[model samples]
Target chain A: MNESLRNIWTILKRELTGYFASPVAYVFIVIFLLLNGFFTFMLGGFFELGEASLSRPFFNWHPWLYLFLVPAAGMRLWAEERRVGTLELLLTMPVTAAQAIIGKFLACWAFLALALALTFPVVGSVYYLGHPDGGAIFAGYVGSLLLAGSYLAVTVATSAITRNQVISFILSVVICFFLILAGWEPVTSLMVRWAPAGLVELVTGFSVMPHFASFQRGVIDFRDLLFFASVIVFSLFGTSVILRGLRGA
Target chain B: MIDVENLIKEFGPKRAVNGVSFTIRRGEILGFLGPNGAGKSTTMRMITGFFPPTSGRVRIGGHDIAEEPIAAKKLIGYLPESAPCYSDMTVNGFLRFTAELRGMRGAQIDAAVAKVAGLCFLEGVLHQSVDTLSKGYRHRTCFAQSILHDPEVLVLDEPTDGLDPNQKHEVRQIIKRMGQTKAIIFSTHILEEVEACCSRAIIIDRGTVVANGTPAELKARAETAGSVHLRVRNVAAETLKSKLGSLPVAGRVSLQDNPDGSLSARVFPRDKSTRADLSLSVAQTATQSGWSFDELHTEEGRLDDVFRAITLPDSVKNRE
Candidate 1:
């Protein structure tokens, strides 16, 4: 078990270093921050809302924001390896495919976490302007990070399915878009007209919206945390299966 | 240190590798030879544990690759066919990353990386990013990663494929030197490379081992093996053919018209395994007939002939 963790750490370090070694990491970070700023200040109406809480203005936008950015950050994880033929090099090593999958997923998640943490100035502004609930802000950050992880994990699985990065990116975006739209109020209301109420509830239960909303409400519900954790674990498991299928083929 | 038995790999409806098997002991360099899509790379992938066999087994240093992949993998170092490395990293960083994955730590990773860099002649570009390096350097960097752990078994798929003549020679020398200690298997389309370094060679055709032997043994399978060639300046083509063909030891004779109006006669030995030298018999026949010859030698056969003869028959088979 210790050896397995060490191998995961080794793969994680290499992937994280790979991100920083090129212009992609810096470029992605800049774009993420710029988009976050634009969404929060202009479209999200942070100033128009005139509230100390970041729940409505800040955290609410993450499910949509991560739909594209997280896929962009994670699409190259396995796709580039397959394209460059390094997938053979990586899997033939002493490390197991599961370890490599987890390591790469964590590296991208950590980078997303870093990009999320860089938004501290917005949190500081909330504090400077008024007395904001620190607990709720912390929960919002946690929720946002989990949202990115869920999207990234799905991207990782899609990335493992193809060698072309564009195809992987498009596939991930489509899947994650469904994850968001299934429970988005506008889309769910559209489904409620023809669909049975239980079916509508079942489909909405699959989306990340309500679970992410709980954190925004300053409630650390175990069920909500379970939803996010299961998303990550299930998607990473799918990635492992895809990797094994690639080898077998 | 490497044993493969009845290894079968099927991709959907296609059987890429079918019951292919071979074993390599320590200090033996086994050359894998085949036409394109003849399952050379697929077999190498299985031996390196990249792909599990559909029905057989690969044991590296007595550890079953299917069951104890990490242990078997730890005993083997593989340089994949395309020779891939992370282009985002410096050569030094890439080597270090590979070393760490191989279970090295702290100062050991640095030393192993430096050692392999020197061995693969990558010292000059250790700090340069892999993407900026030329093909030869990038290939060597990947080769360096394979040897960094100094494993007992090494699988290199076309190690000298993209190298220039000089680099090819250097890489061959390295393989020859390393083959004295480690069990090595390398695939190449270059026939001369097999003759240069392989202790033994396997020629697979259509997912089967068509021929397997030492360089000399395989060459002996050629139709030209033990044939004698005699070139004479003043002799008529008919006379030379008749004289050489009449010899008791000669099976058949053919004459070629040289540009200089000289006769070039090739005499086949009646028996390839005969201890008598066909060249000597031809020399004696020349003296008896008063025919002066310019060049006379016995053919030892050629690997190129054997490779083509064994592999080209199935050209009609569909290629992927």
Candidate 2:
């Protein structure tokens, strides 16, 4: 493998193992599964709907679910390194800045991907009860992952800006909360007149729920994929910039 | 070899390292000596390519650190002051990870890990998590990681800080051993450590190099260097001063009364080059006069004295 890719893999290996070694991993995975189950069955009324569709119960709530869950995982991404002073150790190594950021960010994304995979039972239930649309379900999983990617990027970027994980978590949640809010129809419709048309369109287009809504219905639009990819790229780039600034500071 | 030329680091309005420059060759242990916040850490950081120098160049072998950091950093093994590492990792695991990061793998990684672990006396704690280890072991683990790949240049920031006497002695011994092959620089404010392990020492104050030379050369700069200390019995202070003053020695001779009713006198030489045989002459004088003496010796001076004199503020120095 090339040097950059090798460095990324090394960081990823450490981070993933770090999660499993700590109590936080068990806590996060358990809470993630429990809350996912509760929201899908009790709140979203999967049984009352009595349909094979996992959209309303599963994919529909991914944006809201990831708003809090993704940051919980991503808060420690850079904040822990800063608090423990390993950022200096890492930056001093032969690895470049991009490798460190991508390695760490991808590790958290992979952990979230594992957490999402645990929800396979939901898919099983939908399949057993009725012959559900595998194509749509696959698309939903892809979109849900893309949604989680966007949120993780936000958390990692914010975490890089500060040493305190609490501040990193809170800042990420607040930013995510607004981004999701812009997608909700009622809130945006009311503000459409008061807000400028272009500003409204930009917020609406950038909002997580709207971009994710198409995937919730298994549409697989290129525009939505583009949105999520752009967010991830821009946030990781910002993390590198912030890290460089800290070194000089 | 490591060469730093005109290295400067400015943190906002404050200059942390100012126009510092030095060169270190293989088998030479360079002691970086300074007080707290005196830019020793900052200078080391720039040399290791951890932080870029604002307006200078650091060349490791032939590669410039800023222009080719990856190539330069590959030749370095750095242990930052606190010895930072993943607290969650086992000692073996962290060492393996660091070895791999430096491009070691498989049996080579294991061999390097075992070598440094043994050299650093970390064999006992290899299985334990880093957070669970004692401060001494945590420090040793970091030291071991630095030497895992055995890079050409070793930069350690206060490698012996917070270690017990035994641990400090062991660490010094390892640095001395490694000094045979690597261009090593270890920073410390402990005056004796420079004399203990370093062949050449650089003393910095307020971001600038104040004195740089061999330990002997620096010690020679002290006011007490090459002075004669004579302890005599059955002699009054006035008699001893008048007698010693009559000698060919052309500087002040002061006497202090000792607790045993003997007189202790310190004699300065006429010039910076005090004769190495001054103590012999003083002994001859005491014997010829039949004056019994407790002790007589020539002082080579201590690095402690040299460090204080060289690093002291100009105002305080001038007042004395």
Residue B161 of model 1: what lDDT? 84
Query: In model 2, which runs have C-alpha deviations exceeding 4 angstroms?
Result: B314-320
* lDDT per residue as tens, model 2, A1-249: 888899999999999999999998889989999999999999989889888998988787788888898999999889998898788788888999899999999998999999999999999999998988888898899999998999999999999999999999999999999889987988898988799999888888768888788888888999889999999999999998899888893
Q: What's the residue-level lDDT of B157 in candidate 2?
A: 96
* Shift in Å, residue A229, candidate 1: 0.5
Q: Residue by residue across B26-68, what tens digits does model 1's lDDT show?
A: 9999999999999999999999888878889999999999999
DockQ of 2: 0.72
- How much of the real interface does each model capture, measured as fnat? 0.86, 0.68
Give the per-residue lDDT of model 2 (tens digit) for B158-259.
999888999999999989989999899999989889998999999999999999999999988888888889988887788778777677753678788878
Best by lDDT: 1
Docking class of 1: medium
How much is B163 displaced in model 2, in angstroms?
A: 1.1
Cα-based lDDT for every prediction: 0.91, 0.89
In order, the interface RMSDs are: 1.2, 1.4
